[model samples]
Target: MYRKIFIDDENAAHRELSIYRKGHVNAIRLNDEGYFVYQSLPISAHNYAALFHYNSIDALNALPFISETKNGLDSWDEAYLPNTLLEKLIGILGDELDAHRETKPEEIMLGWQDSPEKISYWRVISPTEFCSFLESLMAFVKEAQTTGYDLEFIL
Candidate 1:
């Protein structure tokens, strides 16, 4: 129902990792035979990236929301945010995130999934607001990296 994003240290051995759903253990095993396994941080770590993109913008925007039919993939539960968007987000949200960490207080997280009363606002966000929100997410990733985190998208 929901996807998770993870951040960890960069591993030169395994520069890229394959993404799969929780139930696709068998598929992962089959695919793993072809590549060398690289050790990663334990999943229990509080390193899970909290990035989220609402379904509305995902459906209309040209972002990297993976499509099973369009991309000839087998699962609908996995996707990745493209690197370009990721970098842009990091640049936009860096300062805000740093301030949040220093303050340790409740923050207003914006997204296209705002409450029904604010539905009109989210609907009009489309490309701009959504992009800003994504930048915040990328900022989270950048912050995590400074503390020894790498990134992963678990859908």
Candidate 2:
């Protein structure tokens, strides 16, 4: 399972991008014309949020679904963060960003995956790559605020 980040403008235009992941494998499908079609990128929104110091994955996952008009609802197009929340997030992320810059990827383990056979796999993202992503996320949030778009998390 994965989560995709997208920006929808006032005109309902959507620009989607894949979240960064370790050892990513593209999942493709075939259309009627035998043309290969790829869906949105598969990256866990919880994991992505964890990278930003939002370690309440269980809490986030347990949030109740709201109507489409309500902001911060899961599986809805209304995940916009209000100005106050955005400001708080920015403040929190600023410190995290600086810390990430000084930390190396090898020094941090994002998480692990366990298979049925008891195999364990650890995933990590390079500091440079994570910094780039953090920069992009900050830019996206700012742009969303300026353009009246919502910062949505599709889990």
Candidate 3:
């Protein structure tokens, strides 16, 4: 579901647009020598901001998303592609999807637009929609695994 919110920040009145942050989860198929071969349409992390803790550094660091490293660097810190990550991702997405299915919780995205921005914007992710996203992500991960490809989360 789409939601709109009013903000009182006077600084953004005349600005055209200012998107602070963006994230994308994509499944990539690479050739030998690590050359890019293919990439799936990204599943944006914009709606799932809570999962990444938004701007709360402490809470964000605690997430497993930062623990999974590729070549000794945080996986989420860079576009590090680790082939084994999808298996873990499936379990996480599966559990989250199931939770939404069972409890039917309503989640809203809290972003800069919700505070003070030129545009009045926000999102109310309904249970069904969130579940759909989880399902799509799970399916995407499964397909990537089956194809022997790796996933990359660009945040």
User: Model 3: which residue pairs collide?
Assistant: none
Q: Which candidate is the best by TM-score?
A: 3
User: Model 3, residue 10: what's the lDDT?
Assistant: 40
**Each model's C-alpha lDDT?**
0.31, 0.41, 0.51
True lDDT of residue 138, candidate 3: 77
Tens digits of per-residue lDDT for model 3, 59-118 = 223334432343222223445445666676677676676656654444443444333334
**Quality of model 3 by C-alpha lDDT:** 0.51
TM-score of 3: 0.57
List model 1 lDDT by residue over 60-91, tens digit each. 22444344445311233433333335444354
Evaluate model 2: give its lDDT. Answer: 0.41
Better of 1 and 3 by TM-score: 3
Q: What tens digits encode model 2's per-residue C-alpha lDDT throughout 31-137?
A: 23553323222334333534534333223333332335554433323232443355555555566577667765553333333433332222444566666666666
Model 2: C-alpha RMSD to truth?
A: 13.5
For candidate 1, report its TM-score: 0.27
What are the TM-scores, per candidate, against the unseen true structure?
A: 0.27, 0.47, 0.57
User: What ranges in model 1 sit over 4 Å off?
Assistant: 1-64, 67-76, 92-96, 105-152
Candidate 2: residue 114 Cα off by (Å): 7.8
Looking at model 2, residue 21 earns an lDDT score of: 30
On lDDT, the leading prediction is 3
